[model samples]
Target: MAFDTKLKQWTSLGLGTVLMTGALAGCGEATKPADTPAAAEVSETEANSHAGGDHHGAEADAAAPATEAGEGEGGVTIEAAYTDPVVYKSAIAIAAAHVLAARDAYAEGKTEAAAEMFAHPVSEVLFDMEPVFASQGVEDFTGLFSDTSAAVFAGESQEQINARTDEILAALDKAAESAPETDMSDAMVSASVASDQIERASDMYVLSIDSDFYETYLDGYGFYKAAELTFSQNEAAIEAENANAASAIRSALALLAEAYPTALRPDSLDADASALAVAASEVQLELSQ
Candidate 1:
């Protein structure tokens, strides 16, 4: 859990810095540069005018018809509103997949991969749920969803992830209650199934690590192939006296070790034909530098 703790600490520090910077920048007298006072004043005046214009423009756009103003402009679609139930259900399913994939990635120490998986449902899938929220009179569910998603991407513990997932499901249930026409049964079931999968996968993956299951399991064959290809490339670089290429290859090998630490050690690199071929292609791209 060192990585998780470090990630959370980093996120807290980063968010604090961003907020503090914004606060300082917002304070007119505090933020002014000594040499640029006059220019800053002019810029601030123009910025205020632009902000006012933007506020009015936003109001005007909100008042406009959904089809004319919102749809086709990267805004929420009319379909999203009418199809709230289906969209909400689909988003839940996607979120579930993301949770499982992120947990798996994290277990394997693929921090960046885990972060990417953790972020997708929030940025893409959950954002699509805004229409559903509006339809249900759920005012500004964005903050809650965004915060939870941020926590997940910041490497919150699996317990926190589960709790947040439950929170989301509860919110969805509340929204469904207000919008009585939208059946939430399927969405709820899908969410439950996904949550169960994550729990089971977490246990199984942990046990596998302890038992060296990944190395013994046939599915892990690709990992060995990847390591061998990387090692071979590293050997060639060393033979050619290309220190830089060899160093890069060594870095790639290190990444592979982080990815499959237990089962795919560099010395014992062997895999079945199909898995070896696929792993070769992937490792080639991974170590292309």
Candidate 2:
């Protein structure tokens, strides 16, 4: 799918979340709490069941930017990127970022948010990765998602879900080893994943600018969260390999952080849509170099 088309699909999917949250918040929304790290995690995470992952998937035939943009054998996770190992690994990393965010939501007493985080990837990313997993000769870690999500759905404690998070993330790491042979450094691959997330954040942010629904803002925030997490995790590697790229990502994330301060919709755009797009573009340029 083209980027524009995927953005439309994201908006459509986020509408469902607006409805779901209206039910969840009820009178509780009367409370005016400051952002608790991920205060809007529940609403935003749910809003992005398909939005976050499919940006990387639009490359069902390719991972490149819609006009721009994976590969492993069995079946190409991304047709255009079949030979590029990083795109495959980056795809897996994006899903892990979502799961990681869920763990945080769980620790912060946001079980519903945590559950949505765990559950979305099952529908949004797993099936898409099957072909690449097979091609890479990695064991199918699909069950990890089910096992972890079931724990969340079962009302498991944060510690228990954390254990499950460990399992799912580890399995994803193992699966990432399947990308076809390549010369790219691991840091470069991580940077690519960050770039993908940024691209998605920019896309979702675009939707929020003209929409009335809070979920559109949440959709963008989810991807921004993912991008932030990915960059921080890989900071050492990214910096070691290319300080300029690391700085580029850091700056872009700073702008995004200001723009998406929380999952709740703001009365107006905090960061101009063009600014967000420029930040994403700059970061992509740094990584591409």
- Global lDDT of each model? 0.35, 0.58
Error of 1 at 202 (Å): 22
What does candidate 2's lDDT look like per residue over 21-125, in tens digits? 311221111222222222222232332323233322222213223221232221224554457776676567557756765676667665555555554553354
Task: Give me the candidate number with maximum lDDT.
Answer: 2
TM-score of 2: 0.66
User: lDDT tens string, model 1, 23-61?
Assistant: 111111112222221111112122223210001122222
TM-score of 1: 0.33
Q: What is the C-alpha RMSD of each candidate to the true structure, in Å?
A: 20.0, 10.0
- As for candidate 1, its clashing pairs are none
* Pairs with backbone N, CA or C atoms under 3 Å apart (clashes), candidate 2: 59-62, 61-79, 64-69, 65-69, 70-81, 70-82, 71-81, 71-82
Q: Which stretches of candidate 1 lie over 4 Å from their true place?
A: 1-84, 144-156, 172-289
Highest-scoring model, TM-score: 2
